[model samples]
Target: MSQNHTWLEIRELAEALYCSVKSVYIYRDKNLFKAGTHYYSVGEGKLRGKHIYNLELCRKALLERTAKDSRSNETYDNKEINKLMTRKLDNKNLSYRK
Candidate 1:
């Protein structure tokens, strides 16, 4: 949100981020990016105004979201692995008793 940072139009941002324009709008609509910080509208109309985004802030938010998702996935994978290991150990113990 700093004045030194570049603010880009939705299409430009989408291109810069390697995503579709619709995805950019979805981020805004879903509140993934906070208004007045990551993006803001300009022009003189209620529904016709265009939104400009702070590229850096948007990137940061996206990175943070991705990191959170990956962490949750890792936790789920670890739990599954642990369950499989425990099952294998139980089977091995049964074989030993036979």
Candidate 2:
């Protein structure tokens, strides 16, 4: 861990990020942040434990995720438009045959 990075508890992280605690947990559960990089479990056994998060890592992960999602959305939109254009051309061809 870099000395400049801040590690924070769930509540503190939420406060710092201006989000709810549940949102932070959602990010963890969804695997948006990798263990040992963005966060670490602090407890014994398999029962349950507190998670300390690297604030900088979490922010970076979120930014990457957002960029990836934006690219995927653009690709999806392009595919949909192509499908619609293909359908229209097919309809036109059928009309000419009639």
Each prediction's TM-score against the native?
0.71, 0.67
Instruction: Write one digit per residue (lDDT tens) for candidate 1, span 14-93.
Output: 99999999999899889998889999889895775888999989999999999999878834578788887777455545
For model 2, residues 17-96, the per-residue Cα lDDT tens digits are 78899999899989997788899999888666889999988988888988988877734578788887777455546544
Enumerate clash totals for all models, in the order shown: 0, 0
lDDT of 1: 0.87
Worst 10 residues of 1 by lDDT: 89-98
Off by over 4 Å in 2: 1-3, 75-98
Return the TM-score for candidate 1, rounded to 2 decimals.
0.71
RMSD to the true structure for each prediction, in A, is 6.6, 6.8
